[model samples]
Target: MPNKLEQLKKMTVVVADTGDIEAIKKYQPQDCTTNPSLILKAAGLPGYQNLLGEAKGWIKSGESADDVIDKLTVSIGTELTKIVPGYVSTEVDARLSFDKDAALARARHLIKLYEANGVGRERILIKLASTWEGIQAAEELKKDDIRSNMTLIFGLEQAIACAQAGAYLISPFVGRITDWYKKSTGTKDYPVDEDPGIQSVREIYRHFKAHGYETIIMGASFRSAAQVEALAGCDRLTVSPQLLGELEADEGNLKRQLTPTMGSDKEDKVSEAEYRWSLAEDAMAGEKLNEGIRSFHQDTQKLKDLLTGDQAQEKRAVAQTGA
Candidate 1:
C-alpha cells in the first residue's frame, strides 16, 4: 500500500501556502498561495534577504512605492511559478475590498505586472477578500479575462456568491473557522471528521459539485495535520510548512474522504438569501472575515512604509552624490 501522502495526492492537489521559498523548494508543492501576512513574514526572514534586496534596489531607481511593492510581490510570485508547475496566487490590496472598481483595477495591474515580469496571466490568480463588494468586482473581472481567488471565505454565502460571480477559485479558510470553534468551546479536544471547519468545506464541496459550478474550491489556512487529512478529497488544500512537515512525517493512516462523485451525490437546497442570513448569524465568521481584511490592509500599509523609507534614503544618497 502507498503512503498516506501518496494516497491524498491521488485525490487532490496539495499546495504550499507560504511565502517561504525554502519551504516551497523543499515540499515541491504543485502550486503556492501568498497573502500580505505571509509575504510580510517572509520579508522579515534572513533567508529571504535576496528577494527583499532586489525589491529595495528597484525602489532606489525612483519607482513609486506601489510599483516597488508590486514588483516585490511579483518577484516572489515569479519564483514560485518557476518552482510549481501550476498557478500561483498573488493577492490584491485588501483595503480595496469594499470598492469594486478599485479592486478590479488593482487586479488588472497585478496581472499586468506579472506579465511584464515574464509570468503569463494564466499562471497567476489574483486573490481578493470575498466581501459582497469583492465578489461584485470579481464578476466584472471575469468578463475582462482576469481570473480570481476569493479568499477569507468562511460561510457558505461567500462560497455561493463566488460561484455566482463566476470566480475561477475560492479558498475557504478551514483553520480560522476551527480556531473560532475551539476558542468558543474553550477546549482543544475536537474530532477530525466532526470538526466544524472540515464540515464547512465538505458542505461546500458537495454544493458546488451538485450545482455543477465550475468554480474550484481550495481549502486554506489549516491548523493541524488532521485538518489537512480530513480534507483529503478537496480540489486543493493550501498548507503551512509546519503542518506539511507533520503530514509528511506521520506514519499513521490517512483517509481520502471527499470525491467529486461523492460530492455530486450529497446535495443540499439552500437559497442565497437563506445562506447569507445563516452566515450573518455566525458571529465568528462575520468577525473573522472583517478582521482578516483589516489585517491584510495593515500589512499592505506596512509594505508601503518600507518602500517609502527606501525611497527617502535613496533620495538623500543621490543629493550627497551631487553635492
Candidate 2:
C-alpha cells in the first residue's frame, strides 16, 4: 500500500507559500507564492540579505524606485520559479486594486519586466486581490495573454466572479478565516475538518470543480497541520513552512477527504440575488476585505519608504562631502 504522502502526491499539487528560500529549497514544493508580507519578512532575514543587497545595488544605480521595486520583486520570483518546476505568483501593489485601468497597466508592466529578466509569462502568475475592480482588471489582462491568481478571497460571490472573469487561479484564505472564528468564539479547540475556514475553501473548491469552472482553487494561509490535512485533495494548497514541516513530520493517519470524484452534497446553490444579499449580511467579509486591502496598501507604502529613504540618505552623504 502506498503511504499517505504518496496518495497526497497523486491527488493535489503542493505549494510553499513563503519567501524563505531555505524553506522552499528544503521542501521542494511544486510551486511557490510570495506577497508583500512574505517579502518584507524575507528582506529582514540574514539569509536573504544578499537578495536585499542586490536590490540595493540596483537602487544605487539610479534606477527609479518603482523600477527597483519591480526588479526586486521579480528577482525573488525568478529564484522561486527556478527552484519550483511550475509557476510562481507575484502580486501587484494592493493600492491599485480600485483603479482597474492602472491595475491592468501595472500587470502588463510587471509581465514585461519578468520577460526582460528571462522569466516568461507562462512561468508567472500575477496575483490580484479578489475585488470586483480587481477582477475587471484581471479580465482585461487575461485578454492580453497575462494570467492572474485571484487572492484574499473570502466569499462565494468573489469566487464566482473570479471564475466568470477568467482568472487562472483563486487563492482562498483558509487560515485567516479560521483565526477569525477562533478569536470570535474564544475557543482553542475545533475539529480540523470541521473548521469554518477549511470548510470555506472546500465549498469554493467543490463549487468550482462541480460547476466545471476552469479556475483552479488553491487553498492558502493555513494555520495548522489539521487544516492542511483536511484539504488533502484540493487542486493546490499554499501552505506555510511551519505547517508543511508538521505534515512532513507526523506519521499519523492522513486521509484524502476532498476528492473531486467524491464531493459532499451541498444545499441549493446561491442565486445571484442571494449572493448579493449574503454579502451585505456578512459584515466580517466586507470589513476584512477592505481591511486586507488597506493593510497591503500600507505595506506597499512602507516598501516605498525604504527605497526612498535609502536614496535620500545617499544624497545627504554626497551633499555633506561637497560642503
Candidate 3:
C-alpha cells in the first residue's frame, strides 16, 4: 500500500511549513510557507549563510532598512518558488499586524521585489495576521489583485473576517489550539475527533462549504499526524517537516474525517462589534492570537538585528580584543 501522505495529497493541497530547503526537497509539498521564526532558524544553518550574508551586504544601501528587510524576505520566498510549483507565502512583518496601511505597503513592496526578480505577483501569497485591521488591509490589496494568506488565526471570528475580506487563504492552527486546550483543561490526551484544533478547523471547513465562501481554509501548526489525519479533507494543510515525515512513514488506512457536508453547517454573519467581542470572549483564541503576534514580532526584530551594522567585522573585532 502507498503511504498515507500520498493519499492525503489526493484529498487536499499539502504545504510545507518550514524554510528548510533539504526537507522541502524531500517531501516536495505543493506550497511553502515561512514566518520570521522559520527564517531565523534558517539563517543559522550552513547553506543558508550566503543568503544571510547577502542580506547583510545590502544594508546601508540607498533603500531604507525596512526596504532591505522586505527584499530579504522576498529573496527567500523567490528561492522557495524555484522549488515549489505553487505559490510561496511571504509574511508581512508581524509588528504591522494591527496596522492596516503599514501592512499593505509592506505587502506591496514584497510583491514588487518578487516581480523585479522575474517572479510574478501570481506566484506569491503575502501572509498577514488575521486581525481586523490586517483583514481590512487584505481586502484593499485584493482589489489590486495581490492575494494574501491570513494566518495566526484562532477563532471563527477571524476566519469570517478573512473570508469577508476575500483572503486567498486562512490557516487556522490545529496543534496550537490543541495545546491551549491541553494546558487549560490539564488533559494530555484527546481523541482525534475531540482535539480542539482539529474540531475548530473542521467546523471552519464545514462552515465554508455550507456558506459558499471562497476563501480557502488551510489547517496549520499541527503537533501530530493524528491532527493532520483528522483534517484530511480541508482545503489545505501546512505540515511541519517532522509531521510530514511521520505521515510519509505511516501506511495505515487514513480515513477522511472532515468534509463539506459535515457539521452544523451554519453560515454565520458577524458584525465588527460581534467579531471583536466574540474573539475577546474566547479565552483560548484571544491569548493565542496575542502570543502568536508577539512571538513573530520578537523573531522579526531578531532577523532585522542580524543584518544591522557590520555584523562580521564587529564580531571579529570583539574576538580579537577578547572583550
Give each model's whole-structure lDDT.
Answer: 0.83, 0.79, 0.85
TM-score, candidate number 3: 0.93
Q: Whole-model lDDT, candidate 2?
A: 0.79
Can you write out model 1's per-residue Cα lDDT over 55-129, one digit (the tens) per residue?
777877888777787778888888788788998999988888889999888899998888898889889888999
TM-score of every candidate relative to the true structure: 0.88, 0.87, 0.93
User: Which digits, one per residue and each the tens of the lDDT, describe model 3 over residues 15-69?
Assistant: 9998888999999999999988887776666767788788878885555656777
Q: Which window of ten consecutive residues has the lowest lDDT sum in model 2? A: 314-323
RMSD of 1: 5.9
Clashing pairs in 3: none
Between prediction 1 and prediction 2, which has the larger TM-score? Answer: 1
List pairs with backbone clashes in candidate 2: none
User: Which of 2 and 3 is the better model by TM-score?
Assistant: 3
**What's each prediction's clash count?**
0, 0, 0
Q: Which ten residues in a row have the lowest lDDT in candidate 3?
A: 314-323
Query: What's model 3's lDDT at 1?
Result: 81
